[model samples]
Every structure is written in structure tokens, then in C-alpha cells.
Target: MISGLGALDALSGPQRFGGATGPLAAAQPSVSASDFSSAVAEAANRTIHTLSQAESVSMTALEGGNVQARDVVDAVMSAEQTLQAAISIRDKIVTAYLEVSRMAI
Candidate 1:
């Protein structure tokens, strides 16, 4: 049950979060970018792991592998909740960035 904005496991697959490269990596950071990137990558990995687990559970149930309904439901629900929370966090970040960019500096 990962809660809060730190649960950024919504974006799954090969595309990962905070695995910045090229210019992002090349640029100097006022803050410790490595720590932030590592944290984001960790969160993404956790989310991917959870999603894969849920998918496997569902597939097992479909394949009649003696999977329990409760287990499937719990896994699916956890995945869904994680995804929604991550999305919300992403949206907030985007909004905040936009607001900052719009500021008269």
C-alpha cells in the first residue's frame, strides 16, 4: 500500500521515470540530482514489480492455476491505487513546473 506522491509507478514498461539522460544528465545540478533520480527509479521499479505481480496473478487465475479470488482482487486493487496516486503526483508536478515557468522572474 504505497501512498503519497512518492508512489510513481503508474508509467510502466521500458519507459521509466527519472532515468534522465543526455542533456538532463549532462547539465550541472544545483541540487543532488543523483539522489533524486535514484529515488524516482526505485519508485518506478516498485510500481512495475507490483503491476507485473498483479498481471501474473490474474493470468494464473484465468489459466485455472488455483489462484484465489481474494489474492487477485487485492493485487489488482493495489496496482490500480498505485497508478492513480502516481498519476495525480505527476499532474501536480507538471502543474507546479508550469506555474514556476510562468512566474515573472
Candidate 2:
């Protein structure tokens, strides 16, 4: 049930990444560069974890380890979607950096 924008939404909130809770989530909307970097790192880690899980499921299924076909399909789909989101975010960040660099200062 993860939407296309779910990853992006998660990055905006500390709760999703298991960081500080309560009042931290209620803090101001401004985000520092360090926070942005941490978010990117977290997103990459999540994508990597999903891809690894998919691979593990596929391998188990291939080895006749009693893994269900539907489980494999679900894992693969989740990994694919997560990877797509990461790539999209990376592209947007690069595009924004390029745009900023080109601006006359």
C-alpha cells in the first residue's frame, strides 16, 4: 500500500526513520544540510535492505526452500518500487544542485 510519494513523505519526518520522537516531530519545518544528508543515507539504506530481502526471497524460492511464489513476487515488487523512488530522488537532487550552481552569484 505504499504510494509513489511515500518515500518522499517519510524523509520529511523523523518518526519514519526511528529518530527522535514526540516534540522533535513538532519542531520547525526548516531542514539543515546535515539533516538532508542523513535522510538520503537512510533512504539508501532502506532501498538496499529491500533489494537484499528480495534477493534472499528469490534465492530461497529457487532452492526449493518452501518459500511461496507470491512472497517472492511481493518482495521483488517492493524492491523495484523503492529503487525507483531512490533514483527519482537522486535525479531531482542533482538537477537542483545543477540549477543552483548555474545561478550567478
Candidate 3:
């Protein structure tokens, strides 16, 4: 089974927690239970942000006449697929939590 914090860290990266790295240094975060909630929230937020950006890009391309309509459609579809994956993971987590909760002590 995947650990909660590991999943969250996979989602949030280093920006969610207070951390610093020089311009040349990349942020490296170690996943822990402490970082789980923040990471998952960050992931969900990022997904939404990505979807919004994809929409904006599609719109701009439409207005500027710089790209074919098919490109925009492809971007939107990609964003949708990403969000669906996130949602599916979330549902599985909730189901696992409930199962654990129901276990007899």
C-alpha cells in the first residue's frame, strides 16, 4: 500500500512547506505523514490550476489564430484526464480509510 504522505509529497512538491533553495538549487522534499494533508490539497489545487491554464491557453489560441483548433481540444482533453486520475486516487483513499475504521480493535 502507498503511504499517505508519500502520495501527498508526490502531489505538493516543496513549495507547500516553508523551504528554500538557491536559484540554482532545486527543492527536494521528503514525504512524511506531517506533509500529507498539505500535499494532497496542493495537488488538487494544482490540478484545478492546470485545468484553468489549459482553458486559457485554448482560448488565447482561438483568439490569436496562432494554432489549429485541434491543438486546443487536445490540451483540454489532457487536463480532463489528469483531473480524473486525481479524483480516482482520492476515492480509493477514502474507501481505504473507511475500511480501516471499521476493523475491530
Evaluated against the true structure, the overall lDDT of model 2 is 0.75
lDDT of 1 by residue, 1-102 (tens): 474325334333223334444555435333355655666677767777878899999999999999999999999998898777677766877999899999
Relative to the true structure, how large is the alpha-carbon lDDT of every model? 0.70, 0.75, 0.67
- Could you report the Cα RMSD, in angstroms, for every candidate shown? 9.2, 5.8, 9.3
- By lDDT rank, best first, the candidates go 2, 1, 3
CA RMSD (A), model 2: 5.8
lDDT of model 2 at residue 21? 62
Q: Candidate 3: where are CA atoms >4 Å away?
A: 1-32, 61-65
Q: Please give the range of 10 consecutive residues that has the lowest summed lDDT in model 1.
A: 8-17
> Of the candidates shown, which would achieve the greatest TM-score relative to the real structure?
2
Q: What is the clash count for each candidate, in the order shown?
A: 0, 0, 0
Q: List the residue pairs that clash in candidate 2.
A: none
Cα error, candidate 1, residue 92 (Å): 1.4
Question: Could you tell me which residue pairs clash in candidate 1?
Answer: none
lDDT by residue (tens digit), candidate 2, 1-105: 343344445554564444556765555445566766766776677788888999999999999999999999999998888888778888999999999999999
Model 1 / residue 88 / CA error / Å: 1.1
Q: Model 2, which residues run further than 4 Å from truth?
A: 1-29
